[model samples]
Target: MALSPQDLHRIAQSRGWRDGRVEVFDTASGKVTVKGLRATRHAARYHLLNGVARLLGLPFLQAAPMPGGRQAQQTEVARLRALHGVGARVPEVLHVDEDHFVMRWLGQDHLGDVIQSHHPQAAALWREAGDALVRLHAAGQYLSQGFARNMIVDGAPAAPAWPG
Candidate 1:
């Protein structure tokens, strides 16, 4: 079933999710993370950054604003599919709507967290992450957010794997 905004709100509330752009809830199949996209939600911030970059004559620093609702959602879905197709460890998209999409929950820990906590497998994890990125780039796919915080650590010390 296509989930509307109201339905998402209800599900989030029922599951005691805090108010945020992303919510994670469990279903019979598995846990999924649903993200609501608002094209204009961060317009002011993007505009401000763009203005600053333009004033500094740094066109390359200009940030692209989110596209319209449907387009943004579509782009996200397409990117996820593309990345997955390239054998990149990314969330598997399960459902979508004009304003929201749901993906399988990879894990709870971020790569940054694991590295900061000095996990025993940190070095191996880093190596695996680097390998994954090389593979992704070799496939001509790139991640807009390649920061450690944006990378999720699926399995760590016990069963180290590439960050998703």
Candidate 2:
């Protein structure tokens, strides 16, 4: 089910990205996450660092925004849609507005959590996650931030759809 902005605000936690807000809300259907980029002082720091890097002929900080002012929400949606169309297990996008977007929450657990569990199912989970990554890459989907925590594991035999 698609979540409204009001629903997202209701379940918002105090914690979120340094330059944005991320809230996970639970509903009768499942969890949904609302991610939005917020104006923050951190942007200045990033820009400064990027400028210094350019002057020094060094690589820009990974945390710095991409060149040409890429819009995070739109980029993410495009990537998700591409991945999904190629049969990559990925969360279905419910809504989008400028800097904000909502997507179905895969689950509480991610590959990071499962790998640390040491449970018997950990191996299977890892295999599934790996397979999903392979599929995504094979489809030419290159995730700039490829972290295990970004891949969700819902304890189902099949891999849970991924959430960014």
Candidate 3:
């Protein structure tokens, strides 16, 4: 069944999310992350950042802030599809509405958590993340935010199969 923004908000509230824009919940199909694009609290921060970048003559450093509402929802849906089409490890979009969309939950842990926890495979994971970024760039696709906190790390590390 398709989920609407109201349904998602109800679920999020039940899960202890007061006013978050994103919420992760489980369904019969599987776990999913629902994002509501109706908040613009960070718009001013992006505007300031972009203004600074423009003044510095660094157009490439400027990014479009989340437009909020329907436009933001559509843009996010399109970007997710485009990125997934080019073999990027983005979440698969499951459902979309006028102001909200649901995607398959990739994982709960971010790359930043792995680094902070000093995971044994942190270095290898970091290298893999770099390789993924290079691959994405080679495909002519870029992320608005590519920080470690935004990169989700799924599953446990596998032992190398190389023969010594």
Highest lDDT scorer: 3
lDDT of 2 by residue, 1-164 (tens): 55655665554433543244777766655777777765433476677787887788886443546432226566778888777777777888877665566788777777776676555577887887778777777867777566788887776443343221
**Which sequence of candidate numbers ranks them by TM-score, best first?**
1, 3, 2
Cα lDDT computed for each candidate against the true fold = 0.74, 0.66, 0.76
* Model 2 pairs in collision: none
Residue-level lDDT tens digits of model 1 in 48-102: 9999999999989998667656777787899998898777889988777556778
Per TM-score, the best of the predicted structures is 1
lDDT of 3 by residue, 1-164 (tens): 45556656555455333257788787766788877667544578888999999999998999766676677778778999999888788998878755567898888778987777777878898999999898899989988688889999888443242122
Estimate the TM-score of every prediction. 0.74, 0.65, 0.73
TM-score of 2: 0.65
Clashes of 2: 0
